[model samples]
Target chain A: MTTAPGSDRSDGLRLSGISKVLGGRTIVEKMELQVSPGELLCLLGPSGCGKTTTLRMIGGFLNPDAGRLTINGVDHTHSKPERRPTAMVFQNYALWPHMSVAKNIGFGLKVRKLSADKIRQKVDWALDLLGLQHHRETMPARISGGEQQRVALARALVLEPEVLLMDEPLSNLDAKLRVQVRETIREIQQRLGITTVFVTHDQEEALSIADRIAVMNNGRIEQLAAPAELYARPRTTFVAGFIGTMNTLDVGPAGGGVPLDDGALLPCDTFSGAAGDVCWIRPEDLQITEADHAGSVRAVVLRVIPRGHYREVLLQSHGSTLRAFTDGEPDVEQIVGLRATNALVYADDALVQDDEPARPGRAVRAVADSGDRG
Target chain B: MTATDTAPAAPAAPDKPVTPSSGARSPRRWSMLFMASPPVLLVLVFVGIPIVIGIAFTLGYTGGLNSIASMLSVSVYTANGWMPSLAAYGNVLSSERFRSDLGVTIWVTVLTVAIVLVLAWCIALYARLSGGRLGKMLSGIAIIPLFIPVVIGAYAIRQFYLNTGFLVSLGRQFGIQLPSWSYHTPGIVIGQVWVSLPFAVLLISSGLAAVPNALIDAARDAGASLGRSVWSVMVPMTTIPTVIVATFTAVGVMGSFTVPYMIGPTSPNMLGVTLQATFVAYLRPQDAQVIAVVLFVLAAGIGALYVWANARASRSSAVQL
Candidate 1:
């Protein structure tokens, strides 16, 4: 599914059964992906989830222990990084400190043995495109970090490679700059129509920029879908939880219905396949109402934290704690009802069936500790 | 475009309203000056006094009153002819023996600095890139010379390169006639390089440490080979450290006596050896003093370059931060 540059109807980049073993541990496992021309696909996951490793493999910085990578329909699994038609904007923005901004951006073109005029034309275009024209003659060290980040993007774009890879490109920037630079990157990607693979731990960044998001954990893709589809109908528990806050409740069959914690039996017909399924309701989807309102579960408010746009209300039901977002302030210790909307159900730990169930218990406990620590 | 419009523009301004806290700050400033006086006084006593005495001696004013007058009145020193103090300097500068000695010193310094810098760069780059047991061992071996006494190291080098030295004997055992390298310019340069290598390696290795691995990776991703990446990226980025290495090595080699004295040829000697000979063997103290001043000036000129390089490095780094 690879096609050369300027070819139409191309599968921009594909990874089939790609796996990587590092330090006797599989950092990436059997990752399969396909991106159409002019699409930005994000590898979204928490730290150590093999997202960066996958991006590196795609960029030819790391070789897959197994499986193959095809770019524009040609096998590049064993190609050296320089030989691949891929460019990466490193997390640290890796701009050459000794070079001027123009030199840094034109380095790749120069390496390709382009004529000075050709290199200058492309570099100047990138400089104007990224709004970095004023800083072209300044040394990289003299510019701001946000400006350096743009220079890094310009450098990669000057090559006009088939696939652009970014490893948390905005991570080094301040919060305000991160959003600003992120939008700049999105605009550039759309304008150039270069197939792109962006790796980031920030779910919002992925949701805002990517045509599709691949939620990964423990070296495997948990779910790969459009951001709305993944958020509204996550295929797995990890995907549901990682993409955003998911209030997961353990469910079991009781008579003809699935029983929840607060004496409510959800209709079993919708989740008939799995016996021990986990229901995932996003915090925003869980509407908090007065106790008198018709609801799925009754809970006592534990705390309320205002999040500017909405107030996050924490609730306790039986032995489980759940969170919900509300527009109004919910009093602490007040009994309230939580109604789930757009809830999803997945067979618990199905992707990791070979893993022991005992580990999840410890993982849950660790999550609790970290939650309390925060 | 809207993103740029709303972005928190550069960093926050560093300005803060200043209050006049003279009562609190004056005592702290005075205390700082007081604590800093000892080293300043020590340098004035040791280095400053000797340089003043040496300048007076070179001006042909050895007596206390005449030296004081020479220091006070520059015209008195220059009254005989233009720059009368430069007579001894001119005599030494024109001497055939001194000219050859100066050339020898310059050649040895240049050769030693070049060799030492190359060796140090290779070793340091190896250590930085490999980062394995071999890398650690190479790094350890590079700094071993630093712990060895220079005299002992110089003597060891002489033994290794002499006609009946270890290398020649080893060659003889293999039925080879190896050329004797004892009492030669190359022999002196070898000794100087060996002694000067540790500091150069340490300086350059620290620079290599400061280089982020990602920058090299970026260069590689830009289609540069490993060697090209190092040459274009690492070499340019570490210019200050390299300058520091070259300057320090040159100064060390220019003023060095023990290594050259131990292994260098007796004829066409370096400045260090010739200065000793001029003062002790020929009993020409004034001429030797002239040579010493010239050598000091040459080393000081290099030292000034090092200071400038260091300042530039710091200024650029500050801008980066």
Candidate 2:
């Protein structure tokens, strides 16, 4: 249930060449991105990837040392947080402790100098919308974590901000409550038709909620694409490994149609890349068969992980580990034939400069390590 | 990581059983009181007993029952022939000089408390926002007064404002004639503020520290200006501590003697200095007792406010928990 591309709509929020340096280290460097109106874009990354810092700059908590921030084609790069048309849902759910839930939700309207009647009406509407009528007069600290989260959301929503920025809003929730609240947040964003930028480290959270996901690494956006596209075809190894479970297998040489590490050579028509390329295969793309088969290699099963709908089979062959997904649980130490249904080759940038003889196992490890760095 | 984990089918219900802690609460209550007795006894002996004795003295019960009876009888004969007399209280309240002294004391207390609260809040807010080396230095300087002996501090303030003191001397060097402030109400207030400021600053800083930075950021994100955030968010969140600072500063200023005695005007000084004069200079211990009782009642009023605010703070927190 995601909206289509932003080309049909006006630009809601944009950041061009935004950079921030803290204590002589560049936290965010020359970052450029945009979001369309009525879109939920998730900045998916590991910690220290500058997602929160970017959100802060958009929210006007921190000024960018370079570049500009624009909302609706207007530059607000140096505007104060109060002057910016944005609101944030902090990770800690920073609800005012002394205020009742209703008052906390009404704070933004009151700050805008609205009449008491208007504030009351809007606050009541928000309270009803978030199903917080039962806790209208309850102090935030007296409520459950999920209810507090709803109050934090209502507090921002009442302002009708141009851009709603959420920083790991669901990280504080328990696993079960997380999914419940996640649905609530998504429903509200769509219902309000507001532009939203959500920063999170959970790929599942992004995949489930975002209209588009921007995978970040080392304070840079690696790729930005729809969830389906990002999963099917990742532009970088970091994106492939970070977006979902990906298995890397080594490929030998640039000619002779490329040889696989499992002693099988196939015509390389699916992928074209520089020398010293590695194959990135999703676990679901690999097939397992009987002990001996043509165009397949024999491998001993290492372990099986049951994932309800499917089992993930971990295999060891020629000192390299390979993973495959199947409906059956292959017994440990059982011999099996492995074949690739689909695979995308990526250039091994780190090993290309070494000039050493290509060890298929080492190439796989290097690609996996680079993905881990992201 | 599979999602399909479920509990087994329930069996037939059984009768409820009494919990061990629930049954043990009766005996635990006595042990709780036992644990609390030491501090309770210390407060009774050091604080409660002294207050009782002082009140008794103020009520004309000096040594024995015979002396107390004679004193009360004489007071009754002089006043309205009542068994218990209000003669001393009546006299102290009616005295013109004592009335003026009381006024001065009230004004000084109000002014000092206002000054201390405003300045301390500003300092605390500055430190909280800056959070740099300069902020650290300012906080350190603010707390330095707490370590200085009150007498020494009072003397230092007295010297600084005297005709030949550092301030007047500095003014002379700048070719500006300055008036001496020693033995004046302004000088006394300055000294009292210096002495009382550190406590207010500490309490205010602690309160500001207790509020998470995220709350302030949230306020700003919600479109609150700096002043609006401070008044609507920061100040309200720190109500308990601000009230505490007010109560402590008011009580301390009302009962303080050294600062005013060293720097206040002799004619219309605080009741603390007058109380001292009434007891030692005039040798009127009965009058001093009456004045002291008035002072105690005033301080007790502020103490009651503090206790109420503290109770509300704790009760709300308990409800939250």
Give the number of the best model, judged by TM-score.
1
Here the TM-score of candidate 1's chain B is 0.85
Distance from true location, Cα of B282 in model 2, Å: 2.4
User: Which ranges of candidate 1 are over 4 A from the true structure?
Assistant: A1-9, A253-274, A294-297, A351-374, B1-31, B65-84
TM-scores, one per candidate: 0.87, 0.86
Model 2 chain B: ten consecutive residues of lowest lDDT: B73-82
Model 2 misplaced regions, further than 4 Å = A1-9, A250-275, A348-374, B1-35, B65-82, B173-175
Clashing pairs in 1: A2-A72, A2-A73, A3-A72, A3-A73
lDDT accuracy of residue A292 in candidate 1: 39
The Cα error of candidate 1 at residue B144, in Å, is 1.3
Question: Tens digit of lDDT per residue, candidate 2, span A1-374?
Answer: 12233323266888989999988889899999999989999999999999999999999999999987788776788889998889999999999888899999998898888999999999998989899999999888888999999999999999998899999999999999999999999999999999999999999999999999999988799989999988877877788888789777666343323344544442222342335467666888777877655445567899999999999999975456878899977899999866555556577422232323223343443333232222
How close to the true structure is residue A42 of candidate 1, measured as C-alpha lDDT?
95
Provide the TM-score of chain B versus the true chain B for each model in turn.
Answer: 0.85, 0.84
